[model samples]
Target: MRGDVLVVHETEKPPESWAAAVLLTEHPDPSADAPPWQEEAIRLLRDRWAGPGRLVVFAGGRRGFPSAAPEHAEGWASDWRGTALAHSDVVICRSPGGGCPAGVAGWGAGHDSGRIVLRVPARPAAGERPEPGGPEVADAVTAALAHLGTGAERTGVQRQVPLPIWRTDSFQRWYGAQRAAGNTLLAARPVWSLRIGADRRLVFYWALHAVVHVTAEDRVKDNEVVISRPDIATAVLYVPGATIDDTEIVLVREFRTAASTPDGFVHELPGGSSMRTTDPRSLVACEVREETGLHLDPGRFRAHGSRQLTAPMSAHHAHLFSAEITPEELEVIRGLADVPQGVAAESERTWPEIATFRRIRTERLVDWATLGLIVQALTDRGHPLP
Candidate 1:
């Protein structure tokens, strides 16, 4: 069995110093306490260290840290209890004898560091087997460690400004006057692939250094302009009763006077007006519960991609995600008092009644508008969209 290993240094630590090496090992024997899929991982680590050195073996809930001797051969159990067998440099498993575990047969030198950690699954019995690896696994581990050793360089912070657009003849004239005054309006190039309707799409890009002023004509009477600075946001999509075959996606329908369509009703994915401070995934889950009355499993949701929506007057970037939900989860949401608020308003308006969820065929998904585009984008990115 061959598996990949990673060696990472703590970001807070000095660049020259090594923090820890993590080995994801597996056991082969079927009856072994660890799952069979883990065998490939263990073999990969063993092959990497063909020579004699300190190697810790962790099986079950045994302590494996605080070695009696600095360079002694010992093994210990990891402090945390979890099924995932991975370790960070700061905390490692150590054995009671203060040496690497005897279960680790072949060992070698890892990047020099004072602390070492080993993670093992909590199982009933410990299997005693001397599993060795071939040269290929060893080479693969070395290459993996080399790649992890490189640190990501910190880059300067880039600011984003949200420029809101309102429909007004006077504002257009003001823009022209500003242009004549040597103020150039920046427009983001349309992402050709994201274009949907035949109508030409436009973007209003503003710089942080520019001063934005809203004239009386620019404001709709009794309506305030709500412009949020451009920022990263996450959205989680939850579908109830979803499976490999039968899948049902969750959506919401709201009345929008701004929509030019006949019905003036907009079908959208469950999301919300995120203060640029929220993480995309967190926002999605939070919005789902707030708007549609659904409690979603955060772990099941996966981020797909992001898109910039540029209208001549306003612009925003939508972060997309996909998640799975069960019927039981939907029942819980239906009992809640308030659903997530997916849209924002600057003025008083009649709230649309919640539309009962209707299942639309995934193939005919394009029949819907805003959410359809989002689903299409996710599908194109190879994310599961139902």
Candidate 2:
């Protein structure tokens, strides 16, 4: 992201309207900072800070070290100097105000690419120009700004949400090789996308720094089908029925605010967002243990299709996997079902409410689709469904 500079001053009465004063700066030297999407930032901020004042400070000097501004207070320290050396600098609360603090707030984005971009340099199309990023790119850019605590209201930027993307076989192979070789790619994470809908309707998603192209004919009349997070993993753990003669799996009954279940809790597989944080198999293993206290080896999880549907509203692609249930794992489930989770106050996490669905066949709670997936997986692994 390119460097950014925001200077806010606290004023009294007539200038109290000016308390929301914002000063934007620009450096003449092109290489001094990353290219900025100033136009988009201006439009978004104009709507955000609609007032009697807007000033753009163009540094005719360059980008570099600071020269003392005798006109201003002695202690004033700005992030970007009026020279060609320093990039992405911020100056906040250096001078004193009438009754309030001299500076209310300030924002400075690092020299990355301005927090959002048309495309990342990592995933190379090699001579192929990326599709023209529309408002979606701007939305991501502005959202990244908001996430830096740049707005007046100080809205919380949610980072937990997954950024969605459609990966090619070659790209997946590359990513896998990188991971196996312990080569962490920087161009990943906090996705960026250009979502174009019907009637040229455009909405942006900043999940990762990736892009998806759409032609005009791809638009629908009044309906626009956009998947927020398409690629994910959902797995079912089969365990034993009442007598424990054979093994069965566990299906989670979760009440998600984003998903609408008849009784709030839907019968869904326990899984995690398949990201770099955890390997897909490991994530499934963690989910199984967290939801059912079952400890299964990651290698046991068999992946099937890449188009598993967790919910209709979230029409993203996901992986479906299943594992054989062991008798020892069944005993572990019984042991953890009522185990005390000590205290939920550590990470300020909500105390978990344990629910028991044991003593029931895996097929009893699993939907046909999920049940079918598990059966297929078992058969493919040489263990036919009973």
Top lDDT: which candidate number? 2
Write candidate 1's Cα lDDT for 121-212 as tens digits. 32323575433333433444554334233212111110011111111122334445545755543321111111112321211222122243
lDDT value, candidate 1, whole model? 0.36
Once superposed on the true structure, which residue ranges of model 2 sit more than 4 Å away at CA? 1-222, 239-247, 258-263, 274-277, 310-312, 339-372, 379-386
What value does the lDDT take at residue 232 in candidate 1? 38
lDDT tens readout by residue for model 2, 1-386 = 22223322211011111112222332222223322333344445544533233222222223332222324322223423321111111111111111112132221211221221112121226796533334543554344333333322111111111212222222344335434755444222332344333421122332333222223344222222223442556675665344222435555555455445455544556664533445567777766666665667889888876653544343445577877667676566656544532113422111122222332233355455555555565566565344
Worst 10 residues of 2 by lDDT: 10-19
CA displacement after TM-score superposition, residue 248 of candidate 2 (Å): 2.0
TM-score of each: 0.33, 0.40
Candidate 1 vs. true structure, TM-score = 0.33
